[model samples]
Target: MQGTLNEIDIRSILQLIELGQRTGELFVEAHSGLTNTALAESNRSLLSSGGFGYPSPAPQPDERFWLVFAIDGRIVYAADRSNNNLLRLRDYLRFYQVESALDSTQVPLPSANPLEYACLWGLMENRILTPARARNIIKNTIEETLFDLFNLPQGTFNFEMGPALAPHLTSLEISPLTAKIVKQVQQWKQFYPLIQSPNQCPVVTDRDRLQQILPETTLANLESWADGKTSLRQFSRYFNRELLAVSGAIYPYIQQGWIQMSDGCDGMPTAASEADPFGIAPLLVPSEQEPHQRAPQVVCLDDDTTIGKTVEYMLVPKGYRASALCDPIEALSQLFREPPDLILCDLAMPNLDGYEICAMLRNSKTFRGTPIIILTGKEGFIDRVRARQVGATDYLTKPFGEEELLMLVEKYIGLPEIAPPPVLPSE
Candidate 1:
């Protein structure tokens, strides 16, 4: 129940836990400063138990991530020390378009157990997010976290056996969740050539061109949702479906060039549509006198000068103050001095890549709640899972368009509203 990742593979460890029907938490920590080769060597020890392939060019150390399992050894929840909110639950509710039932300002007290406890409590107390919906959220969250852990390459782990975790919303069998995630990860890899990343926003280039092939219902859904705005990832949330399903639905349109992926904010108000299906003027828009304010600091870390500059360019026009750093080493010091509202980091660098930087920040109390997004050319399955493991809030693929970058930033920290352009009457 206690050993370094070098000693036993995650799959084997999970099997043993399940076999023993263990209940409690498994704590994993990777020592910092281990080179890629050192990491691979350590992981080789893990695979020795059974010959499962380990991640090549292994992850760096400075570890901490946990999996809380039930007596049946089903993973009930997962998190790190820095996680201090029910934001994921909030996000799940919002994604399902049920956030309106709850108030954001009031959050329940912290719990030693899963925040799902607090989340389900709030939803039931207010009679809002719903028990069924809450159960789905918990199940999905735990499965997602387990999927990340299953792909983890190296770390020292300690298992603490104790009574089963309390206030369960739903229980998932480990075997099925594991099997499903494995299949999903493999399937995700297949879509890489056509869909580089889930963050790619699908926009209609020519409606007439698309209308020829797409069904009437499909075309309507595309027009209302695409708008050169929503990312494949966002679409997954809107439909309460998986990322692959959303991407698959639009794949054919992409090939025809009728729909192209663009970088842009979801300018059309989604909240209004979800809230007022009747289509009245937004119930939430501010009056003209309350001029949109500008100013949320954003920090970008990338070795490529162009990428850094491009991020700054995209954010500046949208009323944000952005700073870019090509050196990941220096970026840490800068963040320590002036914490930004959001951070965009690249995965590859000469020293201290995005993963390292993200983990360092996540461990710090100062940056716990701040959003850290990974910007990278690599869209591999393991890469995305690892990004989440280190506390990245989102992942944006390289060569991102202007709107794509802006929309992602807005998703985390909203932008100030600009005045509507003057309407010029036809002469």
Candidate 2:
């Protein structure tokens, strides 16, 4: 029955509700329109069709769904499932029917919502977005919200939400946050399958165009890529295949400079050279060799500590510069006043713990651009999570291997460079 319902019935029901003026409230059907009251009255038939409740009407995949919102007999807004707002309303409707039972004047949107909408608000507060951004952010937030709420299969989730939003979709996007009486109706209309396939997600490509270039493959990676890591191998381990298969699948991308294989890489699985996948760096592989360099600078915040000497001993000739400081507070101050390319600090310090220092540095206008590492005895997934939360670029547990530490450092500071190409390359 859910699959059978179409646009005409949805509009017809909205007309009926306005005509009747009966206002207990209605919630997100999840996927239903109010079946006739007779359908509700009949217990056996409804039960067999999967419920007394409404069906979750997923749109025909990666397409816009229109939700018309009217108040006091006039259309006020619209939202759609593409933005995942339909799913959001589905979650909220599980407790309170947005359609059948809303008391618009009395209720307030949660001050702290457990949905993507809340994070969207946060994104706005940070000035990370602009006026031209509302439509896309709302769509992305809704998609994000729906993905979480329904545990919706990832393929149907998309981030290719473009610059313009239809009026109906925009209405649903903002409905739950407003104080107006919302008389809305939803319609599943097909788009030309916008950025992804009819049932696919976008690949976070530097350009939205690539999703069009490789729809099926993009759909395959949505959930696995959501953690937003740079490594493609990490995304495909879920497929239970050898690394080469995944690499071969995306090899065209590498040739096009979409990813890169790392040095010491034996043609093993590597990202496209351009790394357009990560949306960082272009599709180009640097020379696969260690670079000529002065030394990697490693500054330890705890003065009179053995860390500096140990690092220095491990330093390959022309590979590292190790220095120590007794006072973390002073070191932090000095770091900004006269900075190096990288900083490593102990988490447990006398004047300020690693977290506090990191916050200060991150908040400081001068050090805002610098990357800081934390050396902590506390190390676990949770600890690493917290380290990232506090803005540490990377976390190193106590008793770490020398190689582990350097690799972590290298990943950020980047390899050393040769001198600039002699201006204009004298012929």
Candidate 3:
């Protein structure tokens, strides 16, 4: 069992494929006790927290999404994107048929930003269907496929994304040397805070990977990337020479695992010198785990410190949506337009205090008693009492822990709970 993770092979990869019924490729390499795996769009490493730079645009997938494993710095065995996409589509189809019975046929096929509705289709229209490829597409099934896909978690017998009953792992032996290396990863617990930062991106090196992830593209042009030779950043960008590409364009690619930033390769010097390849990171692959099941949305109303880092970190892992509004005025304006699930307000403001805003929301028929939480540097019972009188649902002092804030949200908003998976034994 110990040796199974040490240096994985294609057999394990194939099992993941067959079980997940995913498509695409899986890559892994091991020397000594270190192991690494790479998940292609088809691979199931989507489960890993910070595994790849890209996720298949197709929403359907093979594994549980969490519990993805890694060998060293690479993916070894993982789910396939194609199969995952197919499963997602199947779910959508089942849902659409169950509720609507094909009567409301708007033709809800998988759609990518640039690819055709039939891009996945292989035939002359009759039976030719392109399989699922990206994670987003599978998730955003024309609003019609949700009937079947959303009901799968019920009735038990859930499918998992690990080994196929450990088919002769060759040697179950684990060495002390390997365990030592695996233990090194434990020190990174501090980085746990960064895991939920959705904006954090991996490096993108492939153009096709970018093309697959982006909203729209004209693949009809750009020849260098056509051969799969150019880096994803190069191929994916349209006149990508713009400076904003890194922040705007490429960042999303990194988020999706189509590419990855250079992580320290094994044995590479951590201390930088003028000689290294400005990057020494591992190639991004699938995350090797499942995505969070549910996340609550958060509306942060603050102007000066408007950045919602805490909210972003708390909700991103669970795939929650968060919106930031620096001005309480703006937050108030947005509520009538579109109400967020939860609201976080500040006690004092330049023009209006958090209490005043809460009162205004309470007056509204739609927002009355909305889960409003207050954050203030000042700590006093009178202030707390005032906030509660104005309809604040929860309150906290400044400088809060992520868990504390998240708990408040879970209690008030009823967003889904998603527990992260346990870290696997390393090395």
Candidate 4:
């Protein structure tokens, strides 16, 4: 069965599934253009009651799709479609200090199931995580996913009948879970303007004030966690706490102006870059006697191998180090590991397009200042305007020449400087 959320909300749909004891997957895709005006209208009563102060324009989620697997009307698993990258799984594994186990095992490529879900079973099989621990992780993951779903004001959903997800750890009843999440969602709304998203990274703005007010141990913990890189959601995973608890702990500091929250992008580079297994090592310069400075790094992402190679061929010979990636997912992983001096992104690609990628990068602090040039075949005015909206530094039409590519690069990072060779002494 399929319908728009406005006709039948998520709670009612789930209730129907439970009443019928149906087993299958429920796919939900959030409708784009859900403006703050709509949200304000829906929550007008709450606003009048003064339960929460909504931001004039709240931050919308980049994760627009979600999948929930069920068996006999019980939730088997749920995940955000955009977070299919192994990064979320890796973050969870880090809590157990067993993230290294992933390197030795071959993770199955994501197909019907997310890579993270598959890896969870892999971890169980390897004995890296006990069954009880795995079950708890699954529960927490489902809870977090449900929280987001509950907040979704409008979307399209379809429940398809089929066999359940394989190798399930545990199943949860929808009613109890829904009840718990509903209350948490209400509390979450209380910090509306102060804390927009769980994805918002909390940075300690007034360290001196915190030092004076907080105890030594409390201050140290705050310093360690509030490093301006990890988000409140990540903190929940790291501490194994509920999203509300993590946000609540930091909400006061946010209100006091002692902590400032910044928008966060999932899979963006964090403080733990060193632990990134897929990180691309910087190219080494050859002279030992006279150490040369590191060359400016440029990353070009395009599904067309030819386009990637063309960009690399054009840039590398100009004393710049260039890495071309055909796979958008791998490219994002590498980009997070080491943000290049500049990024050249193709506008059209399967799965993730350039606009979405650009928006994701702009959300993060790391790539906020980096130049992002959108490379596309389209030269329409609308395309350029859309690109600009997502924070593209410039737009370059396809079939661009070496000079055109270099000119844009030069405009942003300047021309790569090749040092003059040292003079040899005559014997």
Candidate 5:
């Protein structure tokens, strides 16, 4: 069956599948720029056809989509298309203290299923994880996927009869899982406006106040986890707790002005890095005999001085060498002379637009592989397609937060080695 979410919400769709005892794969795609009229027409068409039809056209590469595998009306597995990277899977494994096994094993070649799914089976085959442990992991993964899917505002869905995912660890009933997730979703909405997204990193703003109120152990735990880099979602995985539990614990502290939330990037290191049992040291430490290494260089090109300075202000504090250029023409000349590690070009400019700048950079072998991110206020699909065509590595919307800027830069060039904070003079 295929139809727009406007015609039938995800909850009703799942109910229908469960009642019918259907066994197949369901594909959901979230699209932008759908009008009310278009949605009405889709609903009418679906009603006339009795709510079952062929699948829609394939989704574009940039579109966000998800897949759920079911057997006998029970959920076998679900995954976000963009999260096919083993990062999410690695996070779960790390929680179980078996992530090292992944590093040692050769990941099987890609198949119809996600690489993470394949890796899970590989772990089971090698006895790295017992069947019970693998099943538990699968259950948690499905719950996390459902939590996000339940919150989707609109999308397209299709279900096609097919073989179940191979080597299935377990199949969970829909109603129970949906009911639990729905409650969590309701609670999550309570934190809205104050805590916008799970990607928002929690930073302790008033350590002195916290030390006075919280137990010494609790305060230390807060300091370790609230390092201004890790997000609430990562904390959930690190502690093996639900998202609501983690966020709820910090909600009051946030309201009390002891904590501040900032946008976070998925490129940050996983919780396992912070939980390393061996306490591994850095590869190299600077000494008087050796020259200090240079920080990652970043350049921002924008006609607005305020935006340019904002970029510089955000990055410089994080140990990056940042320069903001107001003149695109002169900026191009300087860039050619000494190419920065990453370039952030504004979309609208007087003489040179971001597209032209990106194309010009792509032509040169020096900047061909370098990361060029187009910053714009536009959210249309065509603009994104054009940016990709011009060899722009990524796109960021305007009026972005500091964490958003840092996240993109880190994703491309990686975080610089942070210098120790300067000590203050005694009173």
Candidate 6:
């Protein structure tokens, strides 16, 4: 089943699938052109009032945004390639003041479907986020995903019927959930004049000006929230309020020149260098991982002996202890014997393919959250999705350069802080 979002609204699409009790996946990819124009048309005034106005004619979107629905016709799981869901999940966790829990918890690598794994680690596995809390988080996440999808002015969707996602800890009924979300989306549009994009981060303009006219309580809220680090999307999640509602509440301040919107979290700047070719930012933060004296371990697994050898060659000189295995069967045992901080496995291999190896490793408690990057010749969307399904954390296409490999490795395990081998002694 397939059609443009214009031909079939998301609500109708939901009802149609629900009525048929279809079991499969729904994929939505929205191109930038018309979608951006529609969004800008609705909220261009807000943009003009802020730090950066929307381009007169918004530039063409370089890359398409995507959303995936994992359903047994009941909507068991939903994910997006835009990082919107992931950001929402993070803000939702932080909204409940559970940021510290995630700080210590290690998330699996291929977070192409982060909402599912976050629930596993935060809700069921660690109990950091209780089942009940997890449910609310899931609800908010799904709501946000749907809200974004519904608003897309133009997009193509494809549904492939197959076996449904399994072991779902929770499921959302389509009928009522759709109704509630539809209402929320309507209300969200009402705030368009004030909030241009949820991605915009809010920053306080002047404390003195804010204090002069605003009540103490309201002023405090602005101070705590408008510290230039929280995006409007995050602000909404933090309060469990609709995006529009939160924007409306702060609209007065914005108009009074007491606050302004900027890009990134709480007005933090985003670096283009931080984003990968696919636009997915590495979930691992370098500062989050403490520096250590010993080099981090990295293991490369590929049936092609040269590929493994090349990985070792590239990593060894960079202060890493690297090893390579041509046999996937032996790779598992070797991984268990000395668990490397990161593993790179070839996707297509003889005697237990990379997917099987990844699935096997993920089954183990120790490696469940380990970084398992797939080295593949294929870069198609389906192949990447399959890699995620089998628990591969990330993928690098075959014939990748040394810099690509190093960047990925650094993203996961981080680069060692070597002190130049005490150069003073040689001098």
Best by TM-score: 5
Which candidate comes out best when scored by lDDT? Answer: 5
Tens-digit lDDT string for candidate 3 (68-144):
12222222222222222223233223312221222322332333211212222322123222121122223233111
Q: Across residues 1-427, which tens digit of lDDT does each residue of candidate 5 receive?
A: 8777889988888888887878877766677434445433443343233212211333356456666778778898887764335667776676667887987765555454566677787887797965545665677778888887788888877776676676575677788778988999999999988898887988889999988987776677677768678788776765566778788888988999899998855446534234421122222221212222356789999999888888877887787778889898999999999899899999999899999999999998678657899999998999999999999999999889988998998777755644522432121
Give a tens-digit lDDT track for model 4, residues 202-245.
87889898888777767766766676678787766765556776
Q: What's the residue-level lDDT of 260 in candidate 4?
A: 91
lDDT of each: 0.64, 0.40, 0.40, 0.72, 0.73, 0.65
Q: What would the TM-scores of all predictions be?
A: 0.48, 0.30, 0.30, 0.55, 0.57, 0.51
* Residue clash pairs of candidate 5: none
- Candidates in order: C-alpha RMSD to true structure: 23.9, 21.6, 24.5, 21.6, 23.0, 16.8
Pairing residues by index, what is the TM-score of model 5?
Answer: 0.57
- Cα-based RMSD of candidate 4: 21.6
Mind giving the per-residue lDDT tens digits that candidate 2 earns over 181-201?
121101111122131111222
Model 5 scores worst on lDDT over the 10 consecutive residues at 277-286
lDDT of 6 by residue, 1-427 (tens): 7667778877888888887878766656575334433433423332223212223333344534443455545776565543323444556675556755665676554332334444444454675764445645656667777877877777766666665554454566687788887787777677555566777777787889978876776666566666666677766665555666667667777877778876656333222121111112222122213232345788999989888878877777776777888888877888899998899989899979888999999898678557899999986999899999988889999999999999998776656544222211110
Per-residue lDDT of 39-128 in model 1, one digit per residue for the tens? 445433432322122223343454434444565566765543223344445556665556655554243444444444555666765757
Name the lDDT of candidate 3: 0.40
Of the two candidates 1 and 3, the one with more favorable lDDT, higher being better, is 1
Worst 10 residues of 1 by lDDT: 276-285
> Which is the better candidate, 1 or 6, if ranked by lDDT?
6
Query: How much is the lDDT of residue 104 in candidate 1?
Result: 49
Which prediction has more favorable TM-score, 4 or 6?
4
